[model samples]
Target chain A: MDIFNGIASGFEVVFQPNNLLYCLIGVVIGMLIGVLPGLGTVATISVLLPITFGLPPETAIIMIAGIFYGAQYGGTITSVLLRLPGEASAVVTTFDGYQMARRGRAGAALGIAAIGSFIGGTLAIVGLSLLAPVVAAFALDFGPPEYAVLALAGILLVSSFGSGSAWKCIVSATIGLLMASVGRDLFTGVDRFTLDSPQLADGIDFAALVMGLFGLGEVLYDLERRIKGNSAPTPKVKNAWITGTDWVQSRMAIARGTLIGFILGVLPGGGATLSSMVSYAAEKRAAKDPSRFGKGAIEGVAGPESANNAAATSSFIPLLTLGIPANATMAIIYGALLLQGIAPGPQLISEHPDVFWGVIDSMWIGNILLLIMSIPLVRLFIKILQVRASIMAPITVMIILIGAYSVRNSIFDLWIVIAFGLLGFLMKKFGFEPGPLVLAFVLGNLLETSFRQSLQLLDGSLFGFFARPISGTLLVLMIAVPFLVMAVRLFLRKRVAQTDLQKEYENA
Target chain B: MGVPTRRSQDTATQSEEVGVVEADVDDEAVTPAGAWSHLVAGGVPLAFGVVMMLGSINLGLGSPTSPQPGLWPFALSVLLIALSIGLLVGRGRFGPCESFGSGTLTVIAGVGSIAAFTILLPLIGFEIPAIVLAAFWLKILGQESWRVVAMVPILCTAAFHLLFVEGLGVAIPHLFSF
Candidate 1:
């Protein structure tokens, strides 16, 4: 009854004119960011963070969340038509989607993907509605020790499950922690790394840091491999629709994908990209004829598409309930929420129920919007791919500088953006992911706070962390899961198209 | 823990972009020079960690129970030093390390002009710097034609002035109020 009441209230919030309009704008922008290769959701959101400062907290979160999920739909457009995946999650779709397109079933491939994404996203939102409160309820009992372990687990999960080097992820995390350690200490009221700069006393601007790293850094990196001036040959994608046979064939795949995506997405570091890969493998294994995959199989497109959307939706569980972001993009959202002065924790459901339920319910609306807009917008999305990076690069850089400056009306913020931009560029060149660094930085203050608190509670023995039931269990599992996963991976040496998946993430 | 090395297969996998922006990440990312990049990457962090660690020590790290201002940072600095050392001793590409290519000059140029824009903005107003930076990028970085380079930057800067200043009232220091 409470859940239904909550849902009804959520609907009322979402159905408001301004809220609906913001949601619409959010998805459209999300679709644009998704269709464009290289300028990822993280970077786009980073640049937009400053702009969101003016909006109401729920609307800001709703719009940002729409961009996050709308991207799932937008990415599939390029994969089916041009054999180029606009986002990492869409990489697996290219394996079969392009083939399907080559066979003149581009419409069908896209049609099924849209339907699958809609079904998967909607189901995951429903699951999130049901499950997030339970998880939040369970986590409400968590103490400082539990929070410390959970934060550690969150960072570790991001580093381990994320693509590229785990060592680098750790290194990236340390740098982020270092960055977070800047500004005056909240506990003792002493400057740590402000270097006597009055601007840094408040800490490096979050908007500036992210814009430099993800936005400017990405642009500078792209200079090495600049976008071609030539426009793409017009893709001939007519209005796509799924046939009854196509639906029958892919229905089970979508169902299975929904389950896989939901489960993986709820776990730390298990995001849309990971779920899509797992779902593809699951579909391949469950297939009556395995050879049908990677050769224009509708199931290939269906399973991964569904799974990724589901995962994207379900990944919200950890962040909303526990205040632990599951991935880089989630970290940015977590920061956005923090900047809005709304701490994301177990108390979020009670303290900010409208924000909590509003975000959850908005996904339902965003998903429906994506389904309705997918076929109509495919041509426009493809046309956007032709916009040369040269034209957009400087404009984007200008936007970043302005966005950073806009944050606090400080010129120093502009310097911060460029400085971090250089660092971001160098980071990418070195294979150190900026994702973990940003995640760590955003969470750094909380981690340090909980850590100090936990230690005091433990009487500084530190081993007392392992004495508590919940924190101790979590710590043990965090330590054990890597080895368990490694053993499983080694036992099952039958590697799926996992390298290709990693390749896409690296691209992203 | 078995640490990761930049394997030869990773080089193969670096071919991420296929159609338009084909990632030109060749052996350049993992060359003999790349090894030095590894040193720079590791050494910079290590040095920062040691300095910060010393600073934290000076800040008076209390015992774990009675923590001081520097305690948390001290822990982080120590962790940083440890990770940096691992990065140094670890063989092969520790992560996605790239050798600065020819385009790095383009970045340098772009950043340099932007820096000029920042420095000159408050002193000489945002308009001139914005126009200059935009023009430099369009003409030099983008290699646009004389006509485009001539027209776009002025138009773009005027557009920015209108949007941020006149339209939005952002309070960016500008030359003319109107």
Candidate 2:
């Protein structure tokens, strides 16, 4: 009854005219950007973050949440229609989705994906609505030490399991921590890395850093390679309907995918791409005739589509409940929340119930809008894919530069954008992921402050962290995971080598 | 004749699409030529960490019981140095280095124009610098036609002026100071 009441009040917030309008705008923009190849959700969100600076926090988050899930649905369109995947999560869809499209069932494939996404997304929201409050309540008693450990574990998990090598990720995160220390020390009033510049006194602007790293940085990297135009003929969708058998086959797959997606989505480094991959593989393994997969099986489309959407919806759990982002997009949203002066944590639900619940309720409305609009808007989105990156790149760059300047009307921030843009480009060139860096930057101050507070509270005993049950377990896991991974790798290598030697002896 | 040639060009671009896809996937990692590149890449961060650690010592690293301003940063710098060393000795490769391809010049031009715009904005205001940046990107980097190169920057600049300045009342520096 409390959950229902909470959700009902959430719906009341979403029904506000401006909130509804921004939801529509967010989805439309999400779909348009998702239709384009090189422009990703991160870049799009970073570019649009400036616009949200002028709006209410709830409205801003509602629109952003819409963009997040809407892009998940939009990504399916390109994967099914073209062999090209619009987003990383859509990659698995290309195997079966394209085949179904080639067999003249593009409409059915799209229809199934939309339905599955709606089901899965709605289910995940139910899970989030029920689970988020409990988790936040549990975390309410977490002291500075627990927060410090959790933040450390979070950074380590993201960096280790994220896109790049663990060392590279750790180094990137360390740099972020150092960068966050650039301003005046809150307690001591000593400027750490300001280089005697007055502008650096307030520390680096979060907006400027994000705009440069994600927006302009992406544009610069994209310029290195030419954008290839899609030549695949758009599949005709004569029937925008699924057959009875299609529903029968996919019903279980959808259920399985939603569960798989939600669990994976809750983990720090686990995301839509990993969940979708797992779901598709699980569907194939579960099928009576696995050979039919990649040859126009409806279950393939249903499973991954459901899984990715579910993952996207549930990824908000850690962010909304724990004050930690699970991935890059969540990190950007985390920054957006911080920009709005809202510290997202356990207290957020009790403190800013409107933003927390409004965002959750908006996801349901957003999915409904996507389900209704995506099929009709497919043709329009395909046209968006035809726009050359040469034209789009400069425009995006211009927007990023202008947006950075608009943050504080300071030229210094513009220089910061350019500087970080160059740094981000180089980082990408060196195979370093910017995701960990951004995540660490957002959580850097929190991590440092909590670490200091814990030390102060514990009277400078480094071993005091282990005295607490929760922080100790987390700290142990943080230390153990990397060594565990290394040990496993070493064991596997030795086994393989021994086997190779035995094979040589047998041949002799 | 024009139609046939244009169609052929389109097909050529289409044929290159698979390569672009492969390149995008492979763009995540590139095998370095040798340990030298890794050394250089890893060394920069190592040197930065060492310098910062020295600076932190000067800034004062207090006892854990009574921590100073430099304590956290000093610890982080040491960790950074350790990680950099790990990277240097580790067998992993690095880099997705920018090829000296056709777009290299375009990228340089793009960066140059942005830097120029940053310097010029405070001096002359936004309109002229914005127009110049747009013109450079469109004409030089994008290689749009002369007509487009001339028209788009003016229209885009004027539209930006109206939107950011007149509409939103954002305090962007302007020539007229309105």
Q: What are the models' TM-scores?
A: 0.93, 0.90
Quote the TM-score that chain A achieves in each candidate: 0.97, 0.92
TM-score of the A chain in model 2: 0.92
Clashes of each: 7, 0
Q: Can you write out model 2's per-residue Cα lDDT over B1-178, one digit (the tens) per residue?
A: 0112332343445444433443353333322435555675688789989988887887888977788989989999999999899878773543223334555566677788899999988888888988888777766775655755666677777767777788788787887744
List candidate 1 segments past 4 Å from native: A484-493, B1-33, B145-155
Q: Single out the weakest 10-residue window by summed lDDT for candidate 1 chain B.
A: B1-10
Candidate 2 lDDT score at position A95: 74
Best by lDDT: 1
lDDT (0 to 1) per candidate: 0.81, 0.79
Alpha-carbon deviation at A297 in model 2, angstroms: 2.6
Off by over 4 Å in 2: A228-240, A476-508, B1-35, B91-102, B145-151, B175-178
Clashing pairs in 2: none
TM-score of predicted model 1? Answer: 0.93
lDDT of 2 by residue, A290-381 (tens): 88887989999999899999999999999999998988889889999999999999999889989999999999899889988876766555
